[model samples]
Target chain A: MLILLWLKNKLAFIPYFRFMQVLLSHSKLKELISSLAKQLVEKHGSLNEVALVGIQQGGVAIADELVVAIRKQDPEAKFEYGQLDITFYRDDIRKNILTPDRMNLPFAVEDKTVILIDDVLFTGRTIKAALDVLLDYGRPGKVELCVLVDRKEHRQFPIQADFVGQAFETDRKDKIKLVNDEKGNKQVVLITG
Target chain B: MQLSTRHLLGIKDLTQEDISLILSTAEQFKEVLQRPVKKVPSLRDVTIVNLFYENSTRTRFSFELAEKRLSADTINFAASTSSAAKGETLLDTVRNILSMKVDMVVMRHSASGAPHFLSQHVPAAIINAGDGINEHPTQALLDAFSIKESTGGLEGKKIAIIGDIMHSRVAQSNVYLLNKMGAKVTVCGPPTLIPKYAAEAWGVEVNYNLKETLEWCDVANVLRIQLERQNQPLFSSLREYRISYGINRQLLDSLQKEIVIMHPGPINRGVELDSDVADSKQAIILQQVENGVAVRMAVLYLLSGRN
Candidate 1:
């Protein structure tokens, strides 16, 4: 009765719910992650233990969402979370201010599918950094990249996102911002200079 | 020119032409942060190092986030755990990192002249994060930027940096920079912190009590009182510190609502300022934090030659 009652109320709350979403709708990102997970499993066979590594700060949330999405898509898929602190790996560490904490997953990554997630896809250095760190974590069946926004711009590295939400263009100066709300509404916008 | 391989050394190193270029660059950068697409193309191949010896969350993080938004490679090195802790000398570490060939270095050291030292030592451009209560030039610039952006400009403006003037690199830097930009500067702290002939060097007025100074100033930039700073007794207690010189709701009433308030924070909420006052409408502390990134971005881009 409580589930039915909640479902009825949720149906009523749909329009306003979608309108006020900030970053990305949990449902939508979940849907995207699910779609990607389905393709991965269908090609590579059933996932045993899958590890989602976020690129710290922004990427962590996306990885968490993807984990939930993967579990929902394939109930048999075991999930693990990890983060990379690439501060030390950075070339400019000596000249910057304070470093953010290294949020790392202590679990072993042997024989796991490590799908790295980040909020936005830029020049891929951050992804490159994450990849280098994840390589040290352990050998995995495969490493995949997923991002919420993949702005079609010039990238310094030879990497591409396996799963991309939307690709857009920006001037050399303007920025691409994706804001995710508490309710999971995400607005991706292109700013002008 | 590539934005990646430049170094930002000091504010004084920036010519008026360089200053204008950085501000315009920052203006463009700020536009990107507001856009739906929050990533910029500048500094694509560049790497930025956040080397902070001083414990600061605001300025340090602002630079970090700025580097992130600009699509530049960023590295953070706090003093708590690093070669600095390994008893490795600062120049030795800088030389080692320089050998690694990182693009730019943003440095904050507890020792005064550390930034200047880094400037001399490193082949990479060095932006002074904060040096030993000596000169937080960027923080000073951000405060000026916030005030200028809000209240027209700094020309003929009356700005007071109150509390713990002796130990405030912020006050010292702000005094020189704001005066350079044609703002009337006033240093007001308890008599001990506001020592003899201190204002004379900067050619600014000095004030003792909070009341007259609060009324006279257009901007009251409060300094965080390092309680550990008093080698001898300056104030009796935190309560006495608050009662004597703290900027609070009562102090806010003495000035017009438009008069901006500032603090280089990790603010001792009740000691140097009241809680609500720090977050109040007059308080541009957070704005100062935000402007810090944009200003430092400008500073870094200038010294970096990647411009």
Candidate 2:
């Protein structure tokens, strides 16, 4: 395995099979995620057509870990993972970087249970933008939100996470960041105090 | 008490206190801009990137001046001139900048909500310079500031914004801000350009002709005709466009002469406006240009965690 070690800034996984491989080695999040996966499927009951859609960049790896853990119990379950870039749908359209990278909606998401996962949840607007886009394509039987960390702030939209690995109460001034560890495990950290 | 980086994406989310803060801060910066010094050390170590996907001279240069005055190192990045043509995406570019830990990003893109897109993915604070016909918050803010400066703060005044209502982001933004400042705004343009029920949506009166609009308005803001937007030729001809919709010198004669004339320009002389009217002292075209820098500086300073 050619270890592509970029301290940060690898987007879309365009050139390879594994993008966030650099993040898996640090924390024991993989083991913990394994235990949570068993509890989640057992509690929710069934994963036949359920799909995992990650909030791009940091959230994709965690979604992968969750999917792997789910497949362990029910191998026959259909699993589809996708990435969402909600820049265009945002209300604050002026502050975005003038030129975006390549804008791509590379998957067809129609009528599957979308388990939207993000590494850290803050204002919930990103989730809302993603949800708005998801609805534009097709209506799922049930659309659920899952996040590795829930930094509870006043949400502008009426949305909540279905599965939260951890929760933190923070003011508007604080920011929560999540990254993969050196041991191939994901870890969440607080950036601003 | 929060003094860290705060995003200034849209004015819709700002409180009256916030708007006052930005304008007052901008007012101070306006003095700094005029001084022989023409610079300040407030944002000395900061890195400001100008990401303009759309083509604009006035708005882009105003933001450029704002960054320069604050002593911030600025980089000009346009997609047409960058590796984007060779296939580099927008987020990939931001991630690269993120690695550099650049302080803030000011962006103007042709695609609506592009700024909002960057705010979500990137960690840095973002300012929307202008987005595709959605909103130009700073322009509206500065226009409001200029109006307030002239009429003792736009209270109980009739402001008319005339021409190209369908395409003018300036009209959409100013209508809202002026109303917020207690000014009765009248939007005048052709039936095709102005929406059929715009007055209902914007909570401002809409008129089809400029003559009637000018008689009632205290301030008349003229809008430029977008030549590039001529897909099927929006109007019959340039001569016809100027005659019917433009605030020409001939048309200006019949209106209340006290009404201040304004335009967010690259003024097509004799097209959307008469050459004499553009040069007229009543025209705040140049004032808007000059105030644009101060207004943007105020916006940047307001969001930059700098007082």
Candidate 3:
């Protein structure tokens, strides 16, 4: 009976794992992250006073990767990195409540250039919520949005990403996610049912 | 995820999962309280009215502070000062408040099931502050939060609810919450002060001996002797009750193991608990008060998420 139950669980999970199409492979993702780091350096010249605040859970990995890439280039990049949970500020809370992620902004954002990072920029709602959370913390000198994948259409709010790894058109029903493979390699996949 | 029930009428209405969620959410809110800017914009567009029929100090302030920290607009209505003094009904008063575009109501009444009745009649979300001696849900949540903070978790921990178990909403709420969370509970007080069938009805141990109850439990939640709530004499005298059940320094020092002490406030210090015990390092009474705001913030935040 236990074996049958385990087999049923595996059968239920197989289709979800098998049908996903990889939009960005592990190597491509690495290159994209490195190039994004270079782009950030090119734009900011130096990250001494700039701070990278990742929208929690999804954006944390990308932010970590970008920090490592920048450190490899400059060895002394002193940009402050933090994670922000936008659960409290979401506009769709009345519809459904999601569990809050960890928030760890140790440094003050006052008068510093804050770059808000996320994995995918979809309906612009998460970024909007992140902005509200940021302003409540302190008044930053300037704020910029950074994302790896930007769905170029169907934005319910007027918001845009300042830095992007890739921009594409996706169906409103399609799900785009950045996930880790079993070997601990990062990859982007589009799951459709 | 949101809470299972819309109205926090009592701990009896909450599932084990719901209690855990509220505690975890409160953990996050506790971190928020330590921040430089301690206010969050979660309930910015929401307006809550605190309708307190019974006089309160801590619970009222804690709920109002929680609402403020969530950035919700608030209006406080005390029964002594409000139109309720003119014999306005609970439904009529609440309907009048709801007519002013209020989204939620935090209420406390001397009558049990008052919040439950208000919830059925109104479209607004209702949170029971304390409805007579029935249950105080938020107080239990805060108590559980405090216990978790001190003792790690609630599961399998022996907690003794000491003194005035019959008259205490705090004790009853703690019993329901602790039982649901897999904690062992014991009701300890004089025979008259303890409810009949507390052991059978709630599935908790009943012990009249304070020393034995203190030795068996990890945490001792001593309740206040509510002089105002008692219409007739339940105990012989205050001095006798003190000699029998009051937690003193010498009794605690004589215990084989160190036990955490707790109290729901406005303590009749000499009757149920001594000053030294209440102020000792082993006591988390003040931490319980501080956690009240955070737990309440989590409750309001989660409930406001529901449609």
How do the predictions measure up, each by TM-score?
A: 0.59, 0.59, 0.89
| Candidate 2 TM-score, C-alpha based | 0.59
Q: Who wins the lDDT comparison?
A: 3
The lDDT values for all models are: 0.70, 0.72, 0.90
Evaluate model 3 with DockQ and give the value: 0.44
lDDT of 3 at B284: 94
Greater DockQ among 1 and 3 belongs to 3
What would the per-residue lDDT of candidate 3 be over residues B178-260, giving only the tens digit for each residue? 99999999999989888898989999999999999999999999887887889999888899889999889999999999999
Best-matching candidate per DockQ: 3
CA shift at B66, candidate 3, in angstroms? 1.3
Name the runs in model 2 displaced over 4 angstroms. A1-193, B1-5
Can you tell me the CAPRI class of model 1?
incorrect
Task: Tell me how large the interface RMSD of candidate 1 is.
Answer: 13.3
Q: What local lDDT score does residue B240 receive in model 3, on the 0 to 100 scale?
A: 89
Cα deviation of A72 in candidate 2 (Å)? 91
Candidate 1 accuracy as lDDT: 0.70
Cα-based lDDT at residue A124, candidate 1 = 80
lDDT at residue B167 of model 3 (Cα atoms): 88
